[model samples]
Target: MPSPAFTDIQLPAPVLKGRGAIGASDNRYELLSRVALDDGWSQEEQPPPRTEVSFDTSKSIIVQQTALDLPFRQSLNIYRGCEHGCAYCFARPTHAYWGLAPGLDFETKLIAKPDAPRLLTEALRKKSYKVAPLAIGTNTDPYQPIERSLGLMRQVLEVLRDFQHPVGITTKAALITRDLDILAPMAAQNLVRVAISVTTLDRDLARLLEPRAPTPARRIEAIRQLSDAGVPVAVFASPMIPGLNDHELEAILEAAAQAGARTASAILIRLPMEVAPLMEAWLREHRPQRAERVLSLIRQCREGQLYKAKPGERFRGTGPVADMIGQRLRLARTRYGLAAPAWELDCTRFAPPPTLGDQFTLFS
Candidate 1:
């Protein structure tokens, strides 16, 4: 066979509107390396990739959490990828498992588990199943944009309600309010508590940081609505990007508290795997002036790297900068009256739904 000559033809990627990632780089697991370069051709900016959803027929929905550092013992994610294209999303790296680019594909190409409700019911029905607060939205937002049409989250919530199982939900979408009919009753029995993540109060910054997520004001309103409905609402000021929205931490907590958040928590920004380069590119494109400083500070917190997967250090970084951020959060928590004891969901109320065969037992 003759060796074929390859022509060098490089083209620039089109600018996608309403997306956080600057480029759709190849996943880490790819065997081949590919890069794009400007070929001097005039290419107009392209529209954002259309959202696509594929089904995941996993047999189990509940994931047993073995990590002791995490608060929940079990968790469920109704979707594999989130449409809310937050540039700093730690979960973006998970898309690589499907051999997809963790940048754009993580947001544009989604996986939906329509069987989640049934799987959750089956898991809860297991004889060896123990009652514990099951978490939702741990990896991806349960109420992401797709949920509005799929209603899978609502179905899951319905299953939990039927079994009287306790659940802890974390979300950045206001769509959660649509399920107030289900959640309010669960809250009445102390079976549910919700955490609304509000990353930044600045609308413009939030738009750039979390491109498809609900606005900060909308999320705060969701907290208020949930609180007024007698549901315990926690404000999650997560991914506190240093040299960027870190300055808005106090304001975010304050606004959330004022809007009736009973508790507040914060996590320092995490840039693991493919997320590091995506975030770096996003910074250079959106906030060019402060991109270098932001990255430098992130490195300082991560112990001279973009990220460190150590459990304790990953959530809240180390070093003086990390210490200061923690201190500020503590002070703000106390100041905003968010130092209240954590709301514990009732686990004793869990009971498996009666099976079809169990109907005969009603007469007994």
Candidate 2:
């Protein structure tokens, strides 16, 4: 039988307990180092260090179609591997496809699309490009910490604004507030909407779960600022961890509603692929005492499994706990009059960016 430490071995990425890469065809390595103990010995290994980066070249800016039944159809990810480094991020497993670990690598290795604006403009100029709401920061946050230095997301938004195209954004960064000049006008025409994801209101838990992201208070302020500026602001209490953060659901919704959010939504925690191990490790390291209970509750919702990929049940598991959370969300939303978005963004007015060649053709 596998050891107790190996109970949850089905991780998305292989966790190398020692400092060496595992080869598919080789197994001649010696046993990893271990320490003696009174009853049994203990083993310790150092996790890999973080990696820094400059930019990531993206051939295409638009990620065309996704199978998920989300509201938006088309999406754009300005970056990969969020620097916000939320321990429970569902997007972490995506890094493994790039030959990187979903643990520190997902948080450290940065990817930016410097050509995002140019590519977006080019795509919009296409005759076949249908005009629907383009979503930003759907996969990874466009306004992650790197935005402060790179300013890539701002450029993409500028392109969208110039084209008069409809866009939707979801982010936890306060940086979006800096673009009020553009957002306020788009919002006036009902051309844009934004959702701020706030996981918990506890500053300490926020730090441990989402270390680099803005504080809960700052996210609330973001909603307030956007709403006051005529922008439709919504709150997303995402990935409602069962034992870890379920208790904060009502409190989070109340705080966001007070901050001017007119709509609210929630998603149960999803552990796809390698995110399970990465998150389990985080729980063991940060909240050791409650780790078992947390895992148990998560499995209870996931049908006795740590995760379930069923299309209908993935986003919000079906169980008594998940049902209770959904009920509470509905009650909170009703109480605050946040059942629907303050306004709907207009897509009928979407106009493609004009090209120099098109300008001459127009005059001809």
Candidate 3:
């Protein structure tokens, strides 16, 4: 069997983590797979539970010049390689750029920007800095489990609060609830909005889909908590996998609405590079019967391919199947009374920390 093939499935329990886990990184242009010939392996051979893995990040926390399509032109990532282990994350391929496998390594071998708040403060203090609502948790989650100790996200929020910077955040972790004190005050000034990404309502399915994320019930509760605190909250029913969790779209939206989510959004599944093989392996293991059907539907939108990376076409696929998903999402949002919130965050309230130029003027 070809090493790069998505059909090269392997069980992900102890074998995949230890012996069978050896594989090529994405740089090799081959999605490697391992086979274990051990006999008497039971279905109970559950994968060893994941543990914390940490790495260091450089001083630059803010990524400037984001994609034009994004609502915010700048982004701040507190961490790289999310601990959530979401199977369908397009961000997986990014880990490969660090010479790491986008599979288990991307989830377990996490990285943190301890200097994020300091760097953000310095950046905000720059004379030429312009204020736009900075997007948080865009490329990777800021509220992953390790954040409990690191507190990098909280630190960044503190800087934002001090400077009155408008910011947007998205996370699947219920940890966001812990910061309501800061967020509520920021919300009062129209400086913050948050979107909680709830992938599936089924507890078992959520476990398989986003292994480390907070449960669906907890995410709903987070929405209610954030809304109750006077913070504007939105729900993201994202990466609607075809023939898979797509059926849960309306349910997730309705649940979020009932829980006080003011707006809702979703994206079609996007499997790129090593992510394609990784997601396929999980599908085969967990949803064998519908695996091929789901892949077929994905290809239907991707011009008979697993994925197309074009900016416009990547988020939502093109063909009839993709079209139907988009239309269904619109109808569901309307039916649930969800739309972009009426109020706006004020950029004019921005007060960048005093810069060197200000000091020079003071002296002159």
Task: Give the CA lDDT, 0 to 100, for residue 260 in model 2.
Answer: 96
Tens-place lDDT per residue, model 1, 1-364, is 9533333555544447788888787889999967765555576865657999999989888888888679988899999989999989999999999988998899999999989988888888888988899999999999999898999999999999999999999999999999999999999999999999999999999888898999999999999999999999999999899999899999999999999999899999999888998899988888989999999999999989999989767899999999999999999999999999898888888877677767555454
Backbone collisions counted per model = 0, 3, 1
TM-score computed on alpha carbons, candidate 2:
0.85
Cα-based TM-score, every candidate: 0.95, 0.85, 0.87
Best-fitting candidate, scored by lDDT: 1
* Least well predicted 10-residue stretch by lDDT in candidate 3: 15-24
Model 1 RMSD vs true structure: 3.5
Best TM-score among the predictions, by candidate number: 1
Off by over 4 Å in 3: 1-52, 341-343, 353-364
Lowest lDDT 10-mer window, candidate 2?
A: 19-28
Model 2 scores a C-alpha lDDT of: 0.80
Model 3: lDDT of residue 45: 44
With a 3 Å backbone cut-off (N, CA, C), the pairs that clash in candidate 1 are: none
Q: Could you give candidate 3's per-residue lDDT for residues 265-357 as a string of tens digits?
A: 888888888878878777787788999999999999899999997877788889899999899889988999897654578999988666455
RMSD to the hidden true structure, all candidates: 3.5, 6.4, 5.1
Q: Which stretches of candidate 2 lie over 4 Å from their true place?
A: 1-51, 341-343, 357-364
Sorted on TM-score, highest at the top, how do the candidates line up? 1, 3, 2
**Per-residue C-alpha lDDT of model 2 across residues 220-335, encoded as one tens digit per residue:** 99999999999998999997999999999999989998989989999999987767766777777678899999999999899998899888778889899889988998999999
